[model samples]
Target: MSFVDRLRELRLDAGVFRRATDRGANESAPSAFIRPRPIESRSSKEQSVGRRQSSNEFSGRRFFSSAAGSPVSRPAVSSPKKVYPTANNSSWTTEAKEPAGERQVIKVGTGVRPDDPPSSLCPKPRSPKLKVGITLMTRKPHRFDWWLRYHRNLGICHVFVHVEDTPELLPLLDSDEFAGFVTVTTGDDNSLDTHNPNSPDNYYTLMQRQEEQVRRSVVSARRMGIQWLFHIDDDELLHLTEPFSRLVRELGSDVTCITFVNIEATPKSLNAECVFEEIDTFSQHLMLAYRNGKSAGRVSVADWHGPHRFTGRYCVVPVERACILHFESCTYEQWRNKFIKHKEMGEAKKNDIPFPFYRDSVTLFQEDPSGGKNEQRWKAFYQERKIEHFEQLHEDEKIRIRLTSCPKQMIDGASGSFCKWRNA
Candidate 1:
């Protein structure tokens, strides 16, 4: 507490400070505690370095140059950025398919992308010059537009339509919608009796009418340079494992006629709706329909003799992969409406040579023209067509094929033809 004692303590403190100042910031110390720094002339003083190694040396490793003692920064090596590929991305999908908009490229640190699957999986469409046409005689068809669009998507360049009685379809087929695609004919050609096309006496039956239409259509097909002409009813569709063009191109040059086995459709109910969408499960063997199958003859050399038979320099080849999707009595309304209209084909008179379905249907129409009294019998016919169970498939209904898509789907859209559920 005395003034003399305080003065002695102050002098001792001043001496300790002077000794620490002598060492200065330039001195290397074990502890990172505060040190004294002195101002110097600009000539000798390192501008940034000043008289210190680093003001905050503890933040990181501070390496200083031997000459000027300035700090040098050598950043730590960084690991690569993690790239977790998302589902449904270019990580694994077709190269032909790109993102909706302009694509972006992100080059990761020294990372390499693996080669993708070849584009050959989605082959390009065939040349349109190699034309294939369909010769059909449809009368008031259900989903006739769908049939046209389906075959068009299947690479049928042209369609020769014989309007048995559907005059409305004539203009519709000749419209811009089907201008160059369809060749329409009404009344009768020079090939048949023009006077009485509807008469029971002349080409009135289903077989005769169909053959006559096909025969005349073949000449048109040949003249128009249509290589192959197929005769398929509006009730039936051409089903293929691959593209039809590919199959036709694969056929031997010498082969004139191509026959495909028929797969009959088994309706689930009398509720007639969209046939292709509603009907997915088809029976390999024909139960209530013909099993002989349908044929497509090359128009250049072959003549359309019958529905299935072709004449002139014939070399027939069977492709097991393709078949006809026959919607024979697919629905109650379809069955009733189709056959009921052609009562003449039934008991009204001999349809000349009606198919088994027509024969059976027209017989009912013949028995009961109105189908009023035989309603239960008609119901029985529809019920019999239903497949009760896969466990107990009939001998004719052995192999059951569940199509991946609807039979009336584009080749590219088959995988995405879950339209039933989407529309629902």
Candidate 2:
């Protein structure tokens, strides 16, 4: 990289934007619910940590260790305290409250260099970069590329991308941008109900694949020296108020699991083509599907409760408000494609499952699985829920839409990285 080339890549912009209305004044935060929960520092306590030692496995106060099938634990180091950050209570501006087309956050990184050496005034030695990684499942090139760059710029270190649906895209993972950091898997080792990428797989099979991947990725994360690992989807993004590495520095060694709250992102209009780029506004009033969100746990978790959780036992997960921005059904095409896949795969109707969309698809497709009639049914369902205007969200019959800016903060904060990649 020559001086001229490096200079060309440099940029200058506000780290974050504030609206003229400063909706934060009236709303306080995104919602009345955006208050940070008080977590007592474990540094004050002197309780003895119960180290659960297993054959070739480590647990309790350790980073990541699974039993039976896992590799030997790494040489123990005097690790820093474990503590997750308190959710942000920062003020926010909502789309409904602001003028049309007014954006809340538009941030960019200016390639700020590190401070020269720590002076006596700031005597504390800088801690190691908190190596945080994420487990994601991706297929579409456009979607995966954005996800990789966004999370990478936002502070995610290693990425475990399972290109389950499209093995053809596996070669792309070997590219320069993804080579060293990303670990690509194709569910090749594990014998599942299906192997053909084009073949239809039921919802159960997909869940099995996710759980299998979780099992394998934990061992890999541990080997790679990743202390904290989060499991999220391609359509979803983790919106942290602060850096994830810093979040780990705040948590006590006792806590093992973190439950990230999910807030659904509603498109600004009926057909908001691109969900990630176009859709920013979110409703926190608990609408559509379950609100279980996602989870991030230490690689040392013992058993698999589900993909969202690593341990069946008590792992000290906090009651978070909303940390994950879930972009589900933001576009008519998105909704149409999802149901079509579910229908074609012969997804069984699970009564216990609260995912109404999948269940509805099963019932509807029984009448007509394909053709123009099926398309009409999906269109009707989408129209009933789509937010045509700000007023529609304000007066939603199912649930009131209280616009939030949690995701936009992270998105804009890494704007420079996104722009550079787009140009490159």
Error of 1 at 374 (Å): 10
TM-scores, all candidates, are 0.57, 0.59
| Candidate 2 TM-score, C-alpha based | 0.59
Colliding pairs, model 1: none
lDDT of every predicted structure (CA atoms): 0.54, 0.50
Candidate 1 has an lDDT of: 0.54
Task: Supply the global lDDT for candidate 2.
Answer: 0.50
Evaluated with lDDT, which candidate comes out highest? 1
lDDT of 2 by residue, 1-424 (tens): 9987776555322222343234344333211111223222334212111111111111222122222211122333343222222212112211211212311111112222133233455454556666778886664534566667777776677898777667777766898978887988764644333544445554556666777667777888899888777888877877654344433433334446655666567665557545677654554333454455577777775435576665622232221212677777677766665556655544334433354454665566556665356577656656654454222443221211222222233322321111220000
Off by over 4 Å in 2: 1-125, 139-142, 187-201, 269-273, 301-303, 312-322, 344-350, 371-377, 386-392, 395-424
